[model samples]
Target: MGITREIGAHYVQEKGTTFTFWAPDAEQAEVVLHVNSKQTIPLQREAFGYWVGLAEDAKPGTRYTFKLDNDKEFPDPASQSQPDGVHEASEVISHTYNWTDQNWKNLPLEEYIIYELHVGTFSEEGTFEGIINKLPELKDLGITAIELMPIAQFPGERNWGYDGVYPFAAQNSYGGPEGLKKLVDACHKAGIAVVLDVVYNHLGPEGNYTSSFGPYFTEKYNTPWGAALNFDDAHSDHVRNFFIQNALMWLRDFKIDALRLDAVHAILDTGAKHFLQELQEHVNHLEQQLHKPFYLIAESDLNDVRLINPIENGGYGLAAQWMDDYHHAIHTVTTGETDGYYSDFGKPEHLVKTLKHSFIYNGMYSEYRKRTIGTDATANPAKQFVVCSQNHDQVGNRMLGERLTKLVSFEMLKPIAALVILSPYTPMLFMGEEYGEENPFQFFVSHSDKDLVEAVRKGRKEEFASFAWQGEAPDPQSEETFNNSKLQHSYTESEKQNQLRKFYKELIQLRKSVLKKLCKEQLEATLNEEETVLQFTHTSAGLRCVINFSDQPQTITGTQGWQLVLNSADTKWGGPGSDNYTSGVITLQPESVLVLQAKA
Candidate 1:
């Protein structure tokens, strides 16, 4: 194997441009080309596991794959883009599209109403082009930004994109590089920003050939998946650059507005200057150069506000982070699943704590960890945290991959969605969550090695049992599992889906209208731990939403001329029709949420 480059940004004048991969451990390595017909162009080894080649003709729009150890092919270990599905050939693409959002600035973290979805599972087509077709639908639903699950190339055609072998490559199956660009451009044109979920904690099991050429991973730390990245080990500069470069590449190459980094809690680095801090610095620079707003959303189990604190304040300076505690608190209360991490979240006091402060475990004892978990919230701003009721991880981690849609009845569902979207913090929706699709997001793997696939299946089943689940696990290798996960487009036409869609549309619009004013203010939520009643008072565009999350009919005094503007129990939300609460004090039914218009 032969190669030489430290993220070498090169340009070839003759055959377009070319990138090389070196596999010294293998007998052969070939560049599978999508130009001049699909063919494998031979790669020549040079110095130290380095491979070299030239295909100046391999410019943007050209797709190619890498063949290693003779017949075993893989997405390029260094592939920066993928437009096709994950298992297909890599493609050379150009970010040469026109962007009309020259004056479009980020709407601030507090105002964001996010919808989290998997590109493959979002629609029946389950591809980048597929999501593009539904931009209008998302826009109509009033989502400011759509957060797509990981798109990086993994072992199979379908899996949670977290097991990415090529951290840089887009999944070839989801419409490779060019296809992704089209989708992003379409999103921008429709005024909807796209935020991609990325995995930086650890690489997937198969096709992970990074360590062969460089010090990409280390045995010093271990993640649930496998070896940890060499973030703080010797020769760490190269490793750090590899990941930092990847983060930048997605922003610049894909025109992605934001990145949702998966499992940041799993990332390891003990240096004085954390890699996350360094990454944030680079993103800030890119933001300035692009003259456009950009963001970083972190997923962390640790509730330490330290992750979002400014560098000067000893923080990572992330724009926002997923508040898993919020989910734990709500889900535990409703489902009463007291196993695993839910054990610490069962008490009603946990729900009240989170509702009041956005994080219940902030600098408190955690029975699950058997220690004091989380540091104090920055008190700086709650907007730095993103709260959600459901997401890919929570749904897919289950044995049956059942969403709250199937677990909780419609009666109790609307209020939870309302609490999340209308709260003081930003909100994210899992794919198929709006319409309540019932398809299970089963675990699927497609390893080329038969033995490895068997091992994965066995391990997956054992893990599910730990969570007290039982059933015949889906064979990830089967095409049926992937097909089943695809979002059924027919649901959008059904009355329930359409009704839920409209209700969400109204919710997002209401939040935006408020964002035009209350950008950084904290509206206190007074929650009653016993009754499960929460009253929130926030000033928004000459209105105030005093919501009730209780289960019994109750009335409270209202401000003069205050009228009801929206209700979760409305006909539009597929809830039972209720009497008007448009004037004075009104009685609210069980499991209902209400928004009121206050007299100025």
Candidate 2:
């Protein structure tokens, strides 16, 4: 009955509904409701370019559209459900739900072991209900939180979700509003928090009609996708309210535990109060009102600590952010990839520096950008940075959409996993990385425009020029491409795959047990002369991890008091067993990780 009701259609029990629209530019605005009969209701213009109207005959399940100035009708920009598609009418939905997670409490930020997955490809069903069925398996896999790729309503049945046109609408193909609520409810029941990926930088090219109502986008600054969102332009007050309300809708109405803002670096805003800072302030108020924890994690390429820094320190006060440098350092080292951004990495010292300090490029000159980049983030806690060896962008953005399993050997994945899970920062895993999923998570879309489809394909091909990857990119508009990206889920049948899953589970168990009590200050990482051998010590836990990144085995010293806790190269983990320690010296197998603990 507050901000949610102020925008979009709000249905009142046994009392019909109230419809609102923001169309300052339009001379007229009317709600064309599709009920038992075609009903046209004119809305009364309100202050600050808003139109409000009450329809007693309209109730939940009523489909309608807003016609502006005798022009073509358009779906609600803040639509709760776009059942017919992005091009069709919007349906009225009730926010009421029988939530059983009243007593559900979220895990601390440090305790989050995030597993990021795309809903459409995560399961064969490819629905919210599909994810519900897999909740038990995820809970068992030591995943404390599941970060879903953007689920806002996109053009068609399939998309990576960055093309979402309706920011407030639940993707109709993914079971719409009711289905999303059910999945969130189920996740909480399984002791898993839900982190939703949201794109606030720019709307999709197709089916974007927000400009028809008012100045929703500005031509002043352009984004990689299109014109940047008008956060600091004229009529920006309503534009800011639109996105802020959308965030509130996800957290308040759907009960999402956290939001992973997609590409905040592209959100160009030159205002007194930054959009991110303002959004965080609103979320803080909601956290107080709900008496629960809700976090905002940003995906930013800028490498600025101001995003997670406290508001008192002239920062945004976000809980966490995705640190891409950590992934780049690890990927370049393990895969021997030195293309594009990876060229800035590949040195073993880069990974060592990343392990010690979350940002490898903190206030340093970046060879890739040919400019000084990043701010010092060493003052921030390790939990404020989410590190992953493989994520959606890293895997899918490749020319072939290849995962780490495709690029690196089976043995190499163990050390990469150890580096991410055992590191001081919060760790995240891409879907199927736990069990060595072989399927590629290719990018796919279902847009209606044929010309736009061709443009997208061309853009993707051109984007790979810098990486210099050979061959053509898979067709994004092809249904076969989307189908090819689905997880096989047959890891249980494969011996090696199941073993990899077991290895991951063991590492996660260790992280939750001994490593959980250790802070960033207690962690120290060092590299040998050739930089092929890497070792990190957890002083407080008396735990040590040694990794061999070279093709051949390497010997390392200073292990007299430590006993073997876990050996990834052991025969049990589907690897050739390495030689046991002798007289404080040990030979680490090629591409293997060793975990040791102080003997009692």
For each candidate, the alpha-carbon lDDT, in order, equals 0.73, 0.91
Query: lDDT score of model 2?
Result: 0.91
Q: Taking the tens digit of each residue's C-alpha lDDT, what string does model 2 give over 526-579?
A: 999989999999998988999999889999887898899999999889899879
Candidate number of the best TM-score: 2
Ten contiguous residues minimizing lDDT sum, candidate 1: 1-10
In order of listing, the candidates' clash counts read: 27, 0
Total backbone collisions, model 1: 27
Per-residue error (Å), model 2, residue 590: 0.9
Error of 1 at 103 (Å): 5.4
